[model samples]
Target chain A: MNASITPITMPKFGLAMTEGKLAGWMVRPGATVRAGDDLADIETSKITNAYESPAAGVLRRQVAQEGEMLAVGALIGVLADADTSDADIDAFIAQFNAEFSAGAAEEADDTPPEPSVMDVKGRSLRVLDIGHGEGDPIVLIHGFGGDIGNWLFNHAALATGRRVIAFDLPGHGGSTKDVGPGSLEFFSSVVVDLLDTLGIDRAHLVAHSLGGAVALTTVKNAPSRVTSLALVAPAGLGPDINMEFIDGFITADRQKTLIPVLSYLVHDKGLIGRKMADDVLRYKRLDGAVDALRQVAAANFTDGRQTDNLRPVLETAPPTLIIWGKDDEILPSSHAANLPDAITVEILPDTGHMPQMERSEEVNTKIRAFLAH
Target chain B: MSKKSYRQAINEALRLEMRRDPRVIIMGEDVAGGQGGTSGVVDAWGGVLGVTKGLYTEFGPERVLDTPITEASYIGAAAGAAATGLRPVAELMFVDFVGCCLDQIMNQAAKFRYMFGGKARTPLVIRAMFGAGFNAAAQHSQALYPLFTHIPGLKVVIPSSPYEAKGLLIEAIRDDDPVIFLEHKVMYDDEEDVPDESYTIPFGEANLTREGDDVTIVAFGRMVKLANEAADKLERQGISCTVIDPRTTSPLDRDTILDCVADTGRLVIVDESSPRCNMAADVSALVAEEAFDALKAPIRRVIPPHTPVPFASVLEALYLPDAAKIEAAVKAVMNHKVTEAA
Candidate 1:
């Protein structure tokens, strides 16, 4: 095996995923792929997602057969240079299997780190804080009706060099459902309280959809505390909004109806799986969850129009990057238009409101590059 | 989401629903001991297995009523309370013991809405421990969900995992009609990632735990886990299996079953109930009737033999339908080749 040999392993979709099934391989043994090419469709407990290649290389060997169930980090395939000998590839796989089996005992007991509940201002917030590098940390704010798990594809990718903190706002996920007044300022103040509670002096804010408006409000309320801003299909820049999605999200309780409601978030309707709809239904079933969502909708997007127009906050805002899916249904992509030339904007085609999830690679790359400055 | 045992999930569902609705109450033997016994009422054995342990303390004795050992009396009282106003959740302890109270459940609770011209609503839930794994003897250990599922106007729930238990139990409690929620006795200690807040899984939706191309394995309750194990082992041998857990039996998701059979062309039903008159027979019949053109091979059913459950650990284990048995049954159907007309 040459030093260029890169083994393709099972990818964990979320914090709770322990193992996944290789539903099928998208490429043949000798096919070459780019770094982010879809290699296989991995079926987890929650969804069936395309597993992307980690590095650019020629596919040397398909170590794991299609339909095989493997734990996270189990070798599924091998990628190497075209010139590498087949003998060397076989030897490399033998060594990899030897080592994987030896470590299997310790790995059996390896539990995925879970999101913990944090007490902020007498209310509990569910927080998933990852990365430990010494730099200004990044805080992720999900849009209305989303939780920390929505950042499954971006959290670890963006956390390579600095810290990334993803949290469930009040009335979402495992967080306390007492979203006081459900005002943008109330949500923004909770962000301030969270910063104080975590004892961070400065941090980057990356938000999507309604969360973008909240992040902008936080920047306006406490300017010094924020270092940068990255918004995706954000609200608060325009008065136009999709009330159908907002009302449907609060009302659709069954899987049949909820999938259609969630389909508004992405361009690929296939991305809306049964498990995804089930998870939303599960969250909605929690006590006070629907009421909290209703309150937020009534306060922010009152009468089918956005209540706040925080575009003026960009004048003095720190380095900002805005990425909007051109096909966004919840909030019009046109909101990203007419922004100050000083702020950067990237419009992604064939995507929807949740560019962070639908096109995580491009969104993460832009956010990481924007925050590097 | 946090890791919660099947016991904790059920407990949380009951507590949350009771808190949310003042009309919801719980009654069962030893559900709240210490009424005349030694252990504190709040801390006594919640149900026979400590499933509702903390409810007595929080809701006090009034809501968490500890009833006498008479299954007929308490179960009848629960049905009556539900018809009047209160949403009552009564524990039947062991499902086998339901034989003594069949009149209350069958003739009374299950018939209220239909017999009363759809005017009276009976919001009653009967929770019971079922399925055979431990050496709890014949009377204590039996998979008796099929019995209640046969009755009319009854929604029967057999939750497969901790997450399913919580959501399905809450849905049962809130339902306007009568529901029989069966929990596997051996799975109380089984843990899974369950959300803290209350959620309800609709009664009729079939949850496909695994999807594949070769075969569709329909399982219920404890057998769902075994079918999953068998499916994983079969996947390694290149026989991919799609495992479906029909969360409710009374309102069985027949569309999903027929649809999956149409796709896979092979059906394997794993039911823990007795070989005769079991869900396996029912599903096999449905596929034979509606999906006959889709069938590439004869249907296969994996079930326990028609005999009483034994107390001996080894015999009981043999009496149960396990992963090995299910795997064998699946492979047998896979091997069976349909002869075509020449």
Candidate 2:
């Protein structure tokens, strides 16, 4: 009943996750933690992601033990002032459990939003469209061989106060596997069409890697409809790329072979697990996926050099915000150098090609402040 | 992805492959069902257990042929068709019936490419139900994967779950070599989340179901699930284990097995087949020969005794290796110690 106490529950990463295990607590009961700090390691079948603290306070109690599995939204710990009485904390936990078990979770509408197949320009693209607002809606575009799930960490956090759309490109995820032409120009048209199909006129384009090239080409082709561009570890600004990743992503189908290839995407190779390779392999085995990937690779990175230079588009670009991981191996973060004076480029250390995921809270905060102005 | 039973998963794999490729066909005894039955044939039954329930209606009799009850003739015909530019998925009804068609599979189909100087390709899949459970006595129940595994040219697959069933079946249908796809009869109703898209789990790779530090538990087919359960139960008592499911028997994941043994220094193998030359003995020999120096304890096997599958429900339960039996085997291995450190 005390307004000062904030219960730390399990975090749901994706749509499919229902329960997670408290792999271990990163902080003890008496440790003071800030919001967005690592509180514990919560693991699902697919991944073991850090559970961030929701409030800045001392950890008063740990309700769930290490390795204990609990459903999403189940209380795992408590954050409150150091002087909060132990008896008061016990009463609070009792009341919380009673309310949670007596239909509060059912009535709270805590279920994560699900992605659905939407017909865009004669192709079926799986889209997860959530949040709602009047400000320019945000759209996320993942890189090569990526789906809407690539935005797993940032999508929901950034969706606050504005409608955000993350969708699978053609030949990726649950989308139609035919990627027409597989060129940045062709993909740019699809992105523009997707925006039109969603009735999103003048929206923020938050694109990554190959999707960054698409965003640039979209601005070059149709400039009036774009409000701003947030490119993360983007392409089209450089002449160099890690061809090993592109080549391996197409050829390596086995988990043992693919794990090392996926390690190139992250700074911490420990995060690269079998489930990630399995998921990619599952998508690759679908009918036209490999062919589409090959075509995109050929068009985008021919002989390891960037094919289309959309850097010139920046001279007349919209409000641009470029975020790159300093440890990015796929696309060198050095490409963010010598940008236009008006552009805001942020380089995050200790992250890789996927800074949106590896440093989601920081990226979300930057985008929030960037848009607030 | 959604929860699909083993029966549904197999049917979907067959359906997807047939839709993708025109050369694929299905032939077996009662595969189309209702052939020469009390009522007129209308593709009513899918198979003996209805695993192929709806393919007959979708593809029609031209592709879904209900062959004469003779396993020898139909299996031979399937092999011949496969080599002559058709991908035929033939059902053997029960693995015990393989005795009737062993020559066709062992000699003709498996050796087609090699026998003909790498000229002939037999994309043949022979699906059969195996394992002893639900009172399917000796005549109908047998885990005959080792027989197929013995043949060099044949690829033997034993899927553990619905997800594995769908992906492996699709791979089997597409593979150029002769594939013996064994489905445990009791698993048809077992359910798990299987993807809707067509996918393939490559051969010769082991899936580690549980990873731990104390012992390595290698199991086959249904035993993989049991090993996982045992590992979970053992974890509470501080005996951690790493459970491995090799998925395929013929082109076994030897490296994964050897690596696990080298790490844990203890091994427990669970196989539901008759004990003589089953996977347990085969893998036990593998670890003993290659990674002998890494052993801290002797390897343990939780397999059925060398006897025919029993007829009574009570006897059959005793004949099969359960999770409790696997747990006991693991505990024994964890406790075994060698004073010499050899």
* Model 1's TM-score against the true structure: 0.91
lDDT tens readout by residue for model 2, A239-327: 99999999999999777789999999988676777777878887887768899899999988888899999889999999999999999
**lDDT (C-alpha, whole model) for all candidates:** 0.90, 0.89
What TM-scores do the predictions have? Answer: 0.91, 0.93
Q: Model 1: which residue pairs collide?
A: A1-A88
Best by TM-score: 2
Q: Which segments of model 2 are wrong by more than 4 Å?
A: A1-6, A84-111, B35-41, B235-239, B340-342
User: Candidate 1 DockQ category?
Assistant: medium
